[model samples]
Target: MKPIEVKNLKKQFKTTEAVKGINFSINQSETLALLGPNGCGKTTTIGMLLGLITPTSGNIFINEEELNYKDHQFLNIMNFASPYVELPKKLTVLENLKVYGRMYLIKNFKEKIDQLIEDLNLKPFLNKRTGELSSGQKNRVSLAKSLINDPKILLLDEPTASLDPDTGDYVRSYLEKYKKENDISILLASHNMDEVTRLSDYVLMMKEGQIIDHGKAKDLIDKHGRENLEQVFLKLVRQKNEH
Candidate 1:
């Protein structure tokens, strides 16, 4: 089953068009990477998906049901994680998780929180203020909060951005396991080409607010005569600008 379907998605800000009729679908249990340079509308597209921003024009369906910004029923089934977007600075990690769990009306909230704490190895910092934690610690907490409700669709932005290599790999492995166990779908926006290649089943390459190229990561790499995804991305972006 397709977990997400976006058709002719468009978002505009004054004279600038940030997302220009992009279309994509993510199947259940699939991981998709959205790759683009800064100002390429990746974030804008994500905002529309999360109902944080209204699209200028488009259709978005989640699990075959059309999304209504005001009706949060479907929103409960989705969650997003990003180090760039911080939780309340004053809230302790446990408190923050409690708040998010309450928002989702999760049954047995404490049990769920405990499970996440253990699963994410979040025991030591549970009482620490969100603002007091290091960047890598905060990223882990953010991820824990995102999964507090056991969402079916996960949206992540640079999820492993600041972590050391070991921690980053650990987190990636956890995501792979979580998806397989729960049949979760993920849409990741990241510049970490290595992470993308490791986690994503497919990749969409965007430039100046439109999808310029897309394919399976391995296929794209080979098709473009590149040794890696980073090379393929650079080649495509540079080629787009030259034309």
Candidate 2:
């Protein structure tokens, strides 16, 4: 079974249709990029998958089992990372990881925490309060927490946003290595064209709450007669708006 499968997924808020019957899946160890401008319902779609918002209609399955939103046990195997979500400011980096580890009921907490710190190069700031760290550091900590459960499916929302090139590249590289070492599925939502091109096996271009185009990054760029994914993205989004 695929790591994730969303069938005819949809969500509506009052009179507004936030998601217009989107359907997709993430295969084992594959990365699928979700690309679109603001208010295109990318966040809403991810929210639905995370069970933060109940869908008006659809099904989400993991490991071929339908997901029940009330079943936290099912969600234990899934995790998410977003730049906008913050951990507790008062807690130290180690403290935060330890806290999440307990929540995930991770056995051998020391070993798991140590492995994450080594893998993420988070040793230096392990003792610092979360609020004292820079954006890059906080991003790393958030990632470590996400991995506490050793999730099989990861949902990333603009993970590398707001970072300098070096830090962003570092995170990207680390994620690449991690994906290789573990057969994990990733669903990424991002505006960073370079990030998508480097990481995505397939790209879904969404507009007006629906996927207007989808293809491998190179194919989409070539088909749109653009030099790169960013140009193709602009072309499609702007063309839709002009209609």
Candidate 3:
């Protein structure tokens, strides 16, 4: 079954249409990449799916149930992670995880926290204030917090944006293992083409508020006659202003 379905999705600001009639579906156990340049509406689309924003017109279905901003029953089944969004700066890593675990009403909060701390290698910084951590450390904590609830749908924006190569690779490997072991579905929004190509089974390319192209990752690369996903991405976006 598809974990997410979006039809005729649209969002508009006072003078600009941020998202325009985009349609897509993300299947269970699949990783889908939403790729685009700065103003292409990837964030807006993600916000709507997470119930953070109301779409001007659209339909979003998650796990076969329609999502309503006013009544979100499946909020417990979903979680989001973004470096741009931070956990409470004053809270320690463990504290933030504990609060989220309580919010999710996890049955064995301590056990879950313990497992995450070990798996993410977060034990050393567990008691440190979130704001005091380096960028890489904060990213790790953010990821741990996102997984505190054991969500089925994980929405990640630039999951490896600022980390050193080794740490970034570790994060990617962890996500790969997590998804394979748990059958989780991930929606990843990123500018890192290598990361996207490595993790995503399907690719959606958006430009100026609309999806200009989409297909399996390999198919998109081949169709654009590009050496890699990054080249394919540039070809599509550069064409936006030409025509």
For residue 106, give model 2's deviation from the true position in Å. 0.4
lDDT tens digits, residues 181-209, model 1? 88899999999999999999999999999
Model 3: per-residue lDDT, tens digit, 1-243? 789999999998989999999999999999999999998999999999999989999899999888978987778899999999999999999899999899889999999999999988998889999999988889888888888888999999999998899889989999999999989999999999999999999999999899999998899989989999999998998886787
TM-score for each predicted model, relative to the true structure: 0.97, 0.98, 0.98
CA shift at 40, candidate 1, in angstroms? 0.5
lDDT of 3 at 202: 96
What tens digits encode model 2's per-residue C-alpha lDDT throughout 1-243?
Answer: 798888988888999898898888888899999999999999999998888889999898888898888886778889999999999999999999999999899999889999999999999999999999999999999999988889999999999999899999999998999999988999999999999999999999998789899989999998989999999999999996787
lDDT of 1: 0.93
Where in model 1 is the C-alpha error above 4 Å? none
lDDT of each: 0.93, 0.92, 0.93
Off by over 4 Å in 3: none
Task: Rank the models by TM-score, top first.
Answer: 2, 3, 1
